[model samples]
Target chain A: MNISIKRKDQGDHRFLVAVSGEIDVFTAPELQKGLLPLTEIRGGTLILDLNETRYMDSTALGVIVAALKSASRHQCSFSVTGMTPRIQRLFEITGLMELLKRVQTSRGVAND
Target chain B: METQEDESQLSEYRTLLAHYISQKDQKLPTEESEHLRRQLHACGILPEDLLGLHIEALKGAGIFSESAMMRSLNFLMKMMSGYSKAYREHQELKDWQKQLDTELDIASALQKTLLDGKVPACSFADIGAISEPAKRMSGDYYRIVNDGKRLVVTIADIVGKGIPAAMCMSMIKYAMDSLPENSQGAPSYILSLLNRVVERNVDTNMFITMFYGVYDPETGIFSNSSAGHEPGFYYSAREDRFMDLEARGLSLGLAREAEYKEYARRIYSGDMIFLLTDGVTEIRKDHDFIEREQIVALIRRWMHLPAAEIVKQVMRALKKMQDFSLQDDFTFIAIKF
Candidate 1:
């Protein structure tokens, strides 16, 4: 998987992370390593772009949920964007849609 | 006090030295040489008078000294040390990979021994089961124990696969063994006990889905309970229809106080119960899953055969449909009456 994190600007604390490729039990740890620290940045916003992600398993969902919990503790705003329909169904079936924030685009500027 | 001709010659020498220093490839003096020359100039020696002596020193021993050669030698030594360090790390990584492979092999063997143990011989039911892991080891488990009167059968699938899931299977095996013999007939009680053991021992992130059933040879009664397991199929020869064996419960280890409900049915001759892990039902086709109805239809096509033959035929069909490589472990158990 490829995970790239880009800060919005010099003064802005918001970060945009784009993830691509499969995220299964074996590869979720790499995603977690890239995402977990962003959750701890106080008062920051994290926008995860999963437009290119073809597949993800339950372990990957767990990693995302863990990041959400950490983001909550640090008062960071976290949202996921551009999920495929199949991926959306998986999130709904696992009942993770209720826990995670979803947005329409990578910018995540629109109000929910 | 120099003569006019000697002073003129010295001025000419200074001009030549300045011109030489301006040339790119002249190999200028190092900072150390400049420092020494400055100290000499401060002590009242003219820079122009020292130019010829400095040139001679540079040619003889200053820039080409033993210390300069030692510096180059030291750099080569450092490069060699770095290479050796990288080589050692590569060898250590290879050794670690070898060690992990061996350990996984041993664990896989032990898991096979536990799973392929003797199945109970009962007149009321003929059972056949198979567990095929997608990787080197499986996370699926099944065991049938005969307690002289009734036979107890249990099948479970851990949420993950490979070594960690195999380890959880081992923990489940021991926990099953430790259950009281009296609890074998009560599926809910058995699952509740197992849930406590799993909740206490297994990692919270992981959970297991299980189906536990007890069969009585004398009465042809099959009582079963489920812990968030997939709903198995029940084919009745008399009714000529398939029924779903559904129960309500949370997956094991999800919650400490989760309760499982029991269901019972009488098995007549030619009746069969088909139990399977999600691996069989959730086969991937492009971006979608192979429909469960397709699997049920495949079972119906071979419903007339014995339990073992039915399992074999269904697995063969699935293998052909999947192009012989499953994405996850495939486990199925069939009980024919």
Candidate 2:
């Protein structure tokens, strides 16, 4: 499966990147590469969109965990948006929901 | 190296990307937008590919604005990476399965070679032997050697099971090969040599039960000795009955100088001699022993059958009694004169 990245401005220091695909061991590195730079910059919030993701495995879970650590180190808040039930359940199984902020849609950031 | 922290960071970042991509008109600060623009560019999707179609899409939607192109690009990069991870995992699983299948094939071939041996011919005897090792390997072996005037026949079963027993059986075959050409002189003499060979090399817990004999096909007379093996059966079509031959020696590998009693039998046409391991009569049926009655019943039915057919029938009956599962290696050898 191929993943696509879309960028958008979410307020003054928050950038949103939407992701869609089946995330697993093969594609996790691509997800990691896309998020590593933003966390390096240390301030902008990254809103990850996973609503279109139909399935994910343990390696995909690893990618998500890596992104969370990078954000915390940079002191930038990380939020998940547009989580489909499948993605939501994965996050629940991995206990990722407990550690990261989650929202129904990226649209809320614009009003803020 | 920083796997733990990197994983945590990746999760946090994905959460934001999830949020960012869903926003229809989200605006990032100028610096943040540029940073995300570069991240998307690194994924091999040019900024224009993400933006070109979205620019028209935004204008047509009426809710579209200048920031639409950047948001679209960021979303596309996340999708590509997610797909890459899935592809790699599928390949890994396929490779692992292939490796497992190859190993299983090699193990099967090695087991077959260790259990089967070449059959030697004798002028006066027509010998037939067969062994089945269930699902895994087992310790059932039979050998026939033509020693000039006498035909030497040996059938043995190693105690215990699996690959270990098969290994010990191989060692025993090698020990037999080392014996003198005229070694069938006496049962006790041969057993003394065999016991010394086994006890010197094998673990104390390992042992073997064997029935060895010499036959003069010209005279139709057989002389034999047993080392803790099951009593053999001699079937006479003329008499229409089966007689049990005594097993008159201690098991091999237990002690040196083990005594064995010699027995002789004269055979006529339509006379049959059968040698069996415990796995035959010891077959379990409804949690009860199959015993001598069932065995005699089977032999009576197939007394006139060919040697192969007789062995096959016994195996079939044993399988039926064990509910189609043969838990041990079942081996038998038969000679007709």
Which candidate achieves the best TM-score against the true structure? 1
Chain B vs. true chain B: TM-score per candidate? 0.72, 0.67
On residues A64-98, what C-alpha lDDT tens digit does candidate 1 reach at each position? 76676677667778888889986775555433454
Share of native interface contacts recovered by each model:
0.06, 0.00
Record all residue pairs in model 1 with backbone atoms less than 3 Å apart, i.e. clashing: none
lDDT of 2: 0.66
Model 2 compared with the native: what TM-score?
Answer: 0.52
Chain A only: TM-score of every candidate?
0.80, 0.80
lDDT of candidate 2 over B143-180, digit per residue (tens): 87786877887888876566667788889888887887
Q: DockQ scores for all the models shown? A: 0.13, 0.01
DockQ of 1: 0.13
Candidate 1 lDDT over residue span B1-337, tens digit each: 4466445544543343443344455443345334443444454554345545434333423334455544433322322333455568989999999999998898788889977746668777788887788888898888887777888888888877788888899999989877765564489988988989887887645777899988887888999998867678888889988888876566676556657788999888888888888788767766567777888899989877877888889988887787889878888888888
Return the lDDT, model 1, position B191: 90
lDDT of 2 by residue, A22-77 (tens): 66545767877887677555566787887776555434555665566566666666
Candidate 2: where are CA atoms >4 Å away? A1-112, B1-104, B117-123
